[model samples]
Target: MYAPRSPPPSPTSRQLAIIRFGLARIVPIDDEAPFAEIAAAAGLGEVHVRRLIRHAISQHVFQEPRPGVATHSAAPRLIAEDADLAAWVRWRADDCWIAAYHACEAVARWPGSEEPNETGFAVANPTSLTMFDFLATQPERASRFAAGMRLYAAHSDLDLQYLVKAWSWGELPKGATVVDVGGSHGEAAIALARAYPSLSFVPADVGGRIRYMIHDFFTEQPVHGADVYLYRACFHDWSHRYAVRMLQALIPALKAGARVILNDVVVPGPEEMSPGLAAGVRTGDLGMMILFNAGDSEMAEWARLFEAASSGFHFKGGKGHRAQGCGFWRQSGRDIVHS
Candidate 1:
C-alpha cells in the first residue's frame, strides 16, 4: 500500500519568519542562486540562510532546485510579482507577528485601555508613540502599510465604487466638499473626485474641489460645514473610548444638516453569515485588539458608542445595507457610522 502523506505543520511565528526570511533573501534573485550568494546578499552566513530556506521550502514558500540553490516557488513567486501581496505578507510578518505574541501580556497589563499607546504593538516594540505615530516617523514602513492596506481595503469590501454608491452623492448640492478623514494616500478622495468632478490629497495632487492638508483626527475637524465627512475603515483602529473622542472631535464642525459617514466593518452577527465569513470578521476584530486594543462592534455597540461620544448622534439606519460588509449609516443632526 502507498504510504500516507503527513499533514503540513501548523503555522507558528518561526514559520512566518522563515517565509519572510526566505522571501527577503530569495525573491529578488532573477533565478535560482547559490546558497552562499543568497546569504551574501542578505549579509548572513550560507549555512544559516540554507537552513532557513530549507524550512521555508517545507512551507511551500520557496524551492531548492538542486542541492545548493534557491528559487521562488509558487507562493514566493506570486509574492515576487505582486507588490500588494508582498506588502501584505511583509507587514504581517514584520509588524504583526511580534505584536501578536504579546497580546495576552498587553491585555493583562492594560486590561481595557482606550489608549492606543497601551497596545500589544506598543508592548512588543517598546515605543512611546502609538502605532500610527510611529508609522508616520518611519517613511518606508508607512509606505508599506499604505500599500498593504490598499489590498486589504479591496478585500474587506472597502472598494471605491462600493463607497461612492453607498450614499447618494448626486443628491448633494454642487460644490459640496467631502473631507476624507484619516485618508492615507487619499485613494478614496481621488476616487470620489473622479466620479463627481466637482469634488476634491496626500501628494498635493488634489486641488480645486479637493485639497490636501495634514490634520490629526484627534483634533477638531478643520473643514467645518462640509456636506459630508467620511471616515473609511478608520475608527476600528481606536479603542472604544478613543473612537468616541474621534467622533467628539468632529462635533464642532458638523452643521445641522451635515453628515458624518462611516465606511467600516460592522462585527457580523453569528446568524448573519456563514461560519467561514464570520470567522474572518472575528479574526479582524482580534487583529484590531492585538494591534490597538480596539475592535469591530455589533450594531447596538455602535449605537452605544455614538451615544457615549455625544447625545447629538443617532442611527439614521444603514443606507447601504446590501453593500456587503460596507454598510453605511446616516445620522441626522449629527454624525454617521457606516460599516
Candidate 2:
C-alpha cells in the first residue's frame, strides 16, 4: 500500500454532517440525480444539499459526475443499502459524537472519577443514569444502539467465532458444562456448543440442550463447578473495583481446576500495530472511558485484576490471537476465596 498523503490543514466535515442530515435516506443508489431533484427529494433547499454533496465528494462518500449532478460512491452506497450499517453511522454521529465533544467538560466536572454516571455520555445527555440505564428508558434510541452494536460486533475484532476458538472447548470431557457469565443472548455459548457438541447446545447429538438463565454477575454465580466460566466481551464495561466484585462473586461457585476464560480486548502497547488498527483500538479504549468509565486493559492489568479478586486465581496469563486480536485471558480457579 502507498503511504497516505498528509491531510489538508482542515479536513471535510460534510460527510458526517450529511449522514446526520439524513441525506442517505433520500440519495438514490443508481440514479445520477440532478442537484435540484436531490434537494427536492430531501426536502431541503437546493443550496444546502448541493454544498453537502459537494463536500461529501471530497470525503469519498459520494461523487459528482458533472457540475449539477451527483450519485453514490462506494462508501455512501453501502451505508444506504444496509440498515444496520446506517444505524451504526447515525449512532456514531449522534450519541458518540456528542459524548466525544463533551469529554473534556466531563473530566472537568468529575475529575478522576470512575462512576459510570459521571461520564461524558451522562454530561451530554443530561442523565442521572448511565448509558445502559438511560438507553433502557428510550426505546427508539435503544433499538438504534442495539442495531449499531450488532453491526459493530459483526465488523470488528469482537466477532463471536473468535470467542468460540479462543480456547480449546473440545478438550473438556463430554457432558462438561460451560457457564457463560452475562452471555448476552448466549450467542458465544451457542457457537461454542455448536463447535464442541461435548458441551450443551443445539447440536442434537447432545440432545440439543442449552439452558439460558439470567444471573447477575455482581451476585453469586449460580452454576457451580462448570468446566469453563466464560466472560466474553463483558469485563471491559466495568471499572476495576466493580470488575473485581464480579470475579469475587464467582468464588463460592468455582471449584478446583475450573477455568475462567475472559474473551475481551487487551490494550496494545505503543508501536505494537499499524496506525489505523491502533487508532481504532485506542478509540474503543477511550470510548469505554467516556461511556462507562471502563477501559480495555493490558495483560498485566488482567493478571492484577484476578489477583485482586482472589489470591487463589492462578493467572495462567493471556496472549493475542488472530481470531480475537488481543483477547482471551485464562486463569484457573484452583483455590476458592470464600468470604
Best model per lDDT: 2
Deviation in Å, model 1, residue 241 alpha carbon: 0.7
Candidate 1: which pairs clash? Answer: 200-209, 200-210, 262-338, 327-339
> Model 2: per-residue lDDT, tens digit, 191-296?
7777887686311123455777878889998888776777767888999988999998998988878888877767666656677667777777898998988988
Per-candidate TM-scores read 0.80, 0.86
Instruction: Tell me the tens digit of each residue's lDDT in model 1 across 1-339.
Output: 999998754455444554455544454546777888887777778888777778778777677888988887777677767776777676787788789888888889987777788888999888868898989898877877887877766664445776777777767787777888988777888877778776542213655555677888988988877778888778778888888888889999888767777776666567876766667667778888888778887766777888898777766645334345533222112236432
Task: Name the runs in model 2 displaced over 4 angstroms.
Answer: 1-13, 159-161, 201-206, 274-277, 323-339
Give the whole-model CA lDDT for all candidates, comma-separated: 0.72, 0.75
lDDT: worst 10-residue window of model 2: 328-337
